[model samples]
Target: MNAERVERIRAALEDAFAPCAVQVADESHRHVGHAGARDGRGHFAVEIVSAAFAGMAPLARHRAVYAALGTLMQTDIHALAIRALTPEEAHAAASRG
Candidate 1:
């Protein structure tokens, strides 16, 4: 696991969204010999709850995240799966449980 890259991603997201909840996971180990992994870049997943996504649609929220990461998207990520939610949405979802 590349701790530096994980930190880099976490820092970028925190800077961009000031998320109430955010988790970044490097799932590359599961990808092993998979095709995109061959490029040396890693696959990641991010779930973030932030007011930055307050009124945005899902695609827009993802685009915001991508923009925040800027050049890192090209330099580091092979694939990213994102789940972005507003604080209210997050709270409501939790309450449902």
Candidate 2:
């Protein structure tokens, strides 16, 4: 179930943003027995780099991600941690690391 949710998330983001890179990680195990995880929905983290985010503010980028996820926000995902970045920003961060 968790793996399926991660794939759904990745596919949705890819369709919406045409991302240069995208990773969706299921982090539910770390939160086992937590309140949100009780309902069977999973927690996830996404790191995405896309030109679609180039001129967008952080809030806008988050909103766009939420929008792309649509009903999965209510059904499959209990929480989402997002790192939305443009390709240029991704490269800069990677270079520094």
Best of the candidates, lDDT: 2
| lDDT score, candidate 2 | 0.97
List runs of model 2 lying over 4 Å from the truth.
none
Clashes of 2: 0
**Local distance difference test scores for all models:** 0.91, 0.97
User: TM-score for all predictions?
Assistant: 0.94, 0.98
Q: What is the per-residue lDDT of model 1 for residues 5-95, given as tens digits with 9 covering 90 to 100? A: 8889999999999999999999989899999999888999999999989879999999999999988898888999999999999999999
lDDT of 1 at 50: 96
Q: How close is candidate 2 to the true structure, as a TM-score?
A: 0.98
RMSD value for candidate 2? 0.5
Top candidate, metric TM-score: 2
How well does candidate 1 match the true structure in TM-score terms? 0.94
Cα displacement (Å) at residue 43, model 2: 0.4
Q: List the residue pairs that clash in candidate 1.
A: none
